[model samples]
Target: MTGRSGGFGDHSLKTLEESRKTYLQSLRVSTADATFFSHQNALRKFFSWYSPTANKPDSPGNTLAEFAKHLLTTLGQSVDTVAGHIHSLLNFLAFHHQSSPDELRVRLFSEIQLLSCPESAKESLSKEFGFQAGSEITRSVDALRAYLRQRQYGTRTHAYVELILAARARPTQIRLLNRSDLHLDEQTASIPLSETYLIAATGLHNEQTVDLPPDLTNVLETYIEHERKTPSQSGCQPLFTTIHGRASVGTLRRSVKLASEKARDYHCATRETNPDDRSPVDSVTAVVPSDIYRVALSDVENTS
Candidate 1:
């Protein structure tokens, strides 16, 4: 009995032995580039013996199922791992056979059964791949700032960071904001900024005033007057321009990080001179507009 034409035709002892060797080779080659190749290889070898073709007819599908069982029971692979292997093997079969049912479909149900994730395995998978429990927005801000520092971004980059922070923007919002989203009142050097809100609000609620600290305001005013003097591009866009006039999200993120790092280094040096003080000097905290509003409203109530 020989394995030929992409299927096992006979169930003789010699044919079964050949099938086992082929399976072992297949498993070994499948994992050649993977870190867990050796473990997978060993599991396949055990399955070849436990479910020899001579003892049970070798259908492409059944062979896959037997290997899957070996992963679960013999090798003690977690359900997620077993399921992953099964998915890979199923995809391999589907691709090779050019369809789902090609002779291999005979054992598809059993393969699926072997791929079932236990409750414990499900929990483990969730823990490994679940959403992080903190504020993703804050994390994004920190990440962008770190990246900017690593790249040593410049002033335009700082404006971009301010844009995102002031807007309390999500990545998509940052990506979508354009010059149209901002209006420059040169008379007041005030930029009226609009951003998408996570929750719906009353009229014009999504817009926020970006109150730049006096130092930053002065720096920006200088940039706009000295640097952005060139005629506006055909589009009256505010957020991004290829030239020195506006800022892109990538540029902004990088700039924030560079500034943050410089600030940190500066703070560190100052702290070194005053060794008695352990508190971080430039520990900039994100101040969302809502928080500021709440604080201001509380102060007004207290004063009244």
Candidate 2:
């Protein structure tokens, strides 16, 4: 359903091309470089679909609305991705027709509403952390961090764990990061939008800056200075690496899993035991990178 534009008349095609160019030029001054490119790509896709070359008998009497449905249903894009496309299309329409996007959306797409279905905080914690309670999850994370800091500090394992906990990033995002992305002095790291899962999940188009906690910054500094190896290749400076080269996503996940298990075992073994009382450490759950992200979202919702 995407990139099929067989029905548009030549005049319509020319108008779309001109309007797209003018709209992008207008956006250039106000938007960031990554945002400009994202808008450009989204509009190109929208124009491809907007071509009168294709016909739909059940178009809901609105082209934009029909395209939105196609993006969600036929293309199977996440709601966030679909919203980006709709946003770009609305802005383009507003530019060409001299109307506000809000007015255009209401007049043309009043019946369409974009919504997302995600795991509830409790469900997410149970699924990802194997814990039903947020408090237990927090305790597990604290134990894991404490174990890493005391025993594995300055190693790749410690850096990876601290990075995920601080950044609340998926392993996929971490895999795409590079050493150049880190700004240790500023306590931030940039995640590029291209091929990033964060873009699909969060509706962020431009490069994303993840704020680093001071502890993570210090840990990263130690790892880089003493433990990290130079990339085997000249131009590839992956932020996380192994003895060979850049660390794979599998490596990061395995490291996280192992670290969590070790923490659980360490805490369970050393905990003061009473014959009468059930050990609280018995319920401690293993952590994963995604659990951190879910917990972070839950925190934000609670605070808001």
Write one digit per residue (lDDT tens) for candidate 1, span 109-226: 4233444545565454334322221343343345445544344343455444544443333333443455444444421122322222111111122323333345445544544455
State residue 270's C-alpha deviation in candidate 1, in Å. Answer: 2.3
Against the reference, the lDDT scores of all candidates come to 0.42, 0.61
Residue 66, candidate 2: C-alpha displacement in angstroms: 25
Residue-level lDDT for 244 in candidate 1: 52
Residues forming the 10-long window of minimal summed lDDT in candidate 2: 1-10
Best by TM-score: 2
Off by over 4 Å in 1: 1-154, 162-206, 209-216, 227-233, 244-246, 280-304
TM-score of each: 0.32, 0.53
lDDT value, residue 185 of candidate 2: 85
Q: Indicate the residue-level lDDT of 42 in model 1.
A: 45
